[model samples]
Target: MEPLVEENKKLKEAMNRSEKNIQRAHRERDLVESNARDLEYQKVVLSEHLATVKEQLRSKSEQLATASTQLKDASEQLEKLQKVFEEKKVLDCVEPETAPQPDGRPPRPDIIVKRCKTAWESFKSFNRDVVVTDATHALAVVQSHYPATDLEVIGGGYAKGLSEAKTQRLEDEVEDTAKKLAGDTDLFGETNGSGEA
Candidate 1:
């Protein structure tokens, strides 16, 4: 009976040890699961942050493209304006007397007349809104070489003729008589008719 009782005690101790080991294994499993959940949450947060950063990068890239296009357009317009300025500079440099003429005796009367006519024509060919301003500049070139009387006779006459023609045409149109004209006369006409007989 004493031997049996000792055997039973040893069996109960072994059972308790087994139960402790099982409980420790369960605790370790729970720790591993908790660590896995934390890692998954971190991964999700990092992925969302990456997405936000990528969207910001995409938006910035689009803005840069738009700005680059605007810069290119402005550069082209500046180049065009520069070309126009250069052309005007060349036109301003032309001097009737210094310019080569067919008969070089103080620049023949016909040559001077031709130069004035060409200058007026060139002014008229410019944009209508800027025609007067451009004409004033072109006339300054003439004023530099010729006497004031010559400038008045040429530049003043051209300005007066253009203004009067425009005024007369507007008056004729207001009177409903412009359609009966012989032809569409230019600003400079041989006969100064107000689009009527």
Candidate 2:
């Protein structure tokens, strides 16, 4: 009878060890599942972030293209204006006194005065056409191309809304984590089962 009792004690010890191993394996499985869920959630969040960044990059590329075109157009207009000024300079020079009409005598005073008046009128017209009108148009184009931006007006409301949403999400996640922890603690406490094998 004494030998039988000793064998029974050894069997009970083995059973307790097997139960402990099973419980440990269950805990390891639960941990693995939790890690898998966390990895899946992170993947989804990163994918969404990547998509948003792509959209922003596309928008910025479009804006850069438009700005480049405007700058090219403005440069072309300026080059044309420079050519006009060069032509005007050539026109402004004297015509070598008309060669005295090929008669070896001084030209008539009335004719000389008329020529001077015509040249002055031409210069006035050129100034109005090239200097005033074209300059005004170029100024307008430049102003339109680089329009002013007000950050406060553009981002105030949107930034505020985004901040509030982020804060709310953080609070909710913290609350959920706290609840999960409390539940896990309760489960562990119940499974401990009086601290005896």
Candidate 3:
């Protein structure tokens, strides 16, 4: 009986240890599952953040591409303007000397003044033409990039502002030219034999 009782006591102790180990395993499994859920949540958040960052980067890249295209267009236009300027310089160097005065005499003051006025007016016209040409080219570029419907959708204020700015610039240029030619005293006072202002 003592031996059986001792054996029974040993069995009970073994059972308690087994129960404790099972409880410990259950707790460890729950902890592992909770940690796994947390890791999943963090992964979701990081993925969302990464997506947002990628979208922003894409947007920036598109903007940069647009800016680069505009810059390239502007550079091309500048080159064209420079070429035109070079041509104008060459034309100036080769400008015909006022018709030799009849009888080899110096040209009359009136004739000289008239030629100067004509030249000045031509210069002003040329400047205006260049501006108009540049504006036209820019408009063409914009039109090429956007549809007619898109252009129509553009704000009226933007178009108005552009025209107003252009007009203002032209007026300023004319004023400057007038001021410069003002020194001639008679340049604007008389017409070049063509009877045109």
Q: Identify the superior model by lDDT, candidate 1 or candidate 2.
A: 2
Candidate achieving the largest lDDT: 3
User: Please, what are the lDDT tens digits per residue for candidate 1 over residues 42-158?
Assistant: 999999999999997765443333322333333444566557666666545555454445655554444665576577556535534243333444444334543333433442222
> How many clashes in each candidate?
0, 0, 0
lDDT digits (tens) for residues 51-152 of candidate 2: 999997765444333333333333455567667767656445645343345666766444564577587666556644543343334334434654553322
Q: Candidate 1: minimum summed lDDT over ten consecutive residues — where?
A: 174-183
Error of 1 at 184 (Å): 37
Cα lDDT tens digits for candidate 3, 1-197: 99999999999999999999999999999999999999999999999999999997765443333333333334455677667666656444454456656787875444555576577557656655654454444344445644342432222223333465564554454444333332233334475554445
| Candidate whose TM-score is highest | 3
TM-score of 1: 0.47
Candidate ordering by lDDT (highest first): 3, 2, 1
For residue 23, what is the lDDT in candidate 1?
100
State the C-alpha lDDT per candidate.
0.52, 0.54, 0.55
How accurate locally is residue 192 in candidate 1, as Cα lDDT from 0 to 100?
A: 50
TM-score of 2: 0.50
Q: TM-scores for all candidates?
A: 0.47, 0.50, 0.53
